[model samples]
Target: MTTRSSPLPARLKSLLLLSCFLGGIGLMHAENWPRFRGPSGQGLSTEKRLPLHWSATSNVVWKVAIPGEGWSSPIVWGKRVFVTTVTDQSTRCRVLCLDRDSGELIWDRTVFEIVPLRKESKNSYATPTPVTDGKRVYAVFGDGSMAALDFKGGVVWTNREISFYSRHGLGASPVLHDGLLIMPFDGSNRVLKAGIWPNTSDEERLGWQIPWDKAFIVAVDARTGRRIWTASRGKSRIAHVTPNIHGTGRKAELISPAGDVIQGFDLRTGERLWTAYSQGEGVTPSFAMGEGLVFTASGFEKTTIRTLRLGGRGDVTSTHVAWEQRRGVPSQPSLLYLAPHLHSVTDGGVAHCYQAASGEVIYAERVGGNYSASPVAGAGHIYFLSENGETVVIRQGAEFSVVARNAIQEKTQASMAVSNGRLFIRTAGNLYCIGSKH
Candidate 1:
């Protein structure tokens, strides 16, 4: 006869199990600002009441000087904030960890000094933003060197996989999923001029064909820097843009913007899931994902915006695409959707509103100045920061209405990060945190 122990109260057992599950889910969302546009790479913050207006002298909690020259945005986990900056020489790569509340520099580490690398005039060595998993922060340099640092500023591992030429440098920020750090390498080895009579030799016309420069995404273990898997993109230049993970009923798909195509890969196995061809190159913008559809705006000769449904196999180019919008799409900044409508500003500063579900144009208005930073949305308002130090705050709706056109004294090319009911903008000269006191 087996003597079984009496079970605890049924209600108490169920309550304890539910509490543990909820706690795990909460912790999962805590350490995740993971990519170019925050969680999910959507540029939408569920963080409520993020401050709208900020200036150098007003609503500033703290301001700290970031050394070096990098346009990458900041990522935060718990009380620690992480940002990458270039050293004074522009040849050394630096990563700084800051206290989120006090804006104090906790630890500063210079990781690499690039000796030989080719980058476009507009790009820099530290343009790629760092990604963190709460325990480790991963920084990728333009020379194809990626290093993972512990929370206490200790180096875990570093890997220099491939070396190639970047026409505009390394602007593609890394993204994290589970235990993997995903990075994209897209480079072209040739530069062509239109005229000069078309009689130039194939070598003169095309330059050195960099057969090694192919578009591919690699996923490495965040803890050990080991390559978990890599998916090749076959002779393409995919730069600047980051990847977004979308749900496809069965599993999550890692969606990325390769040159002239928006491709999806298996998040678990690094398998090619699907591809949607578009009329774009140098794809730098992140996608807005929701309601079973992913919206992407192409860059640099990207005249159209496309919406593709998630979860398709092979070449779902024809069957998965929902709709495409062709007017005033952005070439640099990423797109933002306020649920029912999509909002974006072109490089020349044309603010556009489109129906998110149907891809219909609602309104088009000029906002002025040139823009490269991804716009931030908060407090029912959309914020557009131009390259000329102009901040345009607009009401989020079908009608294109400007709420406030504010300006700063300095130039800003980096996107603003919102946290703890405050807005942090990193400009060319300084970093400003804006918010009102309680």
Candidate 2:
């Protein structure tokens, strides 16, 4: 006795579903350069036909003057771009939002009024790159402050949790996993709870034992700024290596490098799973992982490049280590892998190529200029950015061949960001967008 309603025709339903699926594919094509090295944190963008050759005068879509000092790179999301800058002699930490299409400065908000601490000559207050997840942007500074701002530049939350900052300042940026913000606080010199540094007019610090255990990796709620998990690096020396995921899929392991050790931990619980051997006191470079091997370069002293086999429990010091490259390793710039070979440009501009699995030296050649910005690879070419504004683009293969020697002729320390077939470079003087009518 009930009236029956007929379903839509099968062909019509299929057509409607196909329409929605294609719409989603269109949205996915709208990419966002989210983190330090784009989406994968490897400086490899899926964006094809990126502008290969660019100068201050050529392919310049828009150039805007940035009014501050920072080493953080620009991150783009949809139609907006985000970057952080610390001005007023490193006292003001600011978050800048710009139009991605026109490079117009839409909003600039000061996140914190910081008292800049003793930092290395090269490290600025706003060295850690801000990360965005379309809803909000996150920034961290040298003065031990991290702030989350909404997409429209409203301050959502701020945390000054670890005041014991080291001398080299904050450089490792926060990474987003699921619903949390992962930040690593690794400093060489630790400040006491009373804010007294080792030699900062406080002779009392000379007699007191400086806590080398102050360094740690922490995760906070992305929306609330509340601590979710923390793992202590009490046995670790100071390091600034940013944490990255190791495994594939939704459940991946987190790996963080310390002074003399690289530890793997559970991302959800922060429980230590394994620790690998990496020698040196200041482990600055982050790890590059793929194909069952995790590659890392130790800090200045010794500078040993290690390739460890991933997926193990407990101590992986000897069991998981695959190979080690002892010479011409980098301390500041991270490693890049292009198929069967791994590439690295040392801080002194020495370019190296090694076998990905065996660590066999393929070729060693010197490019030019002292390098701090990590090399980025694109369009079958590897880009090595130097501190003096020169970028050497080389062919990516077993043999080393320089493609072009391009420059903006301005000092810059940030790595280039590629998005939507355009290259965004932040220098000491200006922010430039490079494109070729794409």
Using lDDT, give the best candidate's number: 2
Query: How would you encode candidate 1's per-residue C-alpha lDDT over 299-324 as one tens digit per residue?
Result: 66646788988777777788999999
lDDT of 2 at 348: 88
Count clashing residue pairs in model 2: 0
* CA lDDT for candidate 1: 0.76
- Over 68-159, each residue of candidate 2 has an lDDT whose tens digit, in order, gives 89999899998898889988988898999999889999999998897777777998888888898889998888876888999888999999
RMSD per model, one decimal: 7.8, 6.5
Each model's TM-score?
0.86, 0.90
- TM-score of model number 2: 0.90
Write down the RMSD of candidate 1 (Cα, Å). 7.8
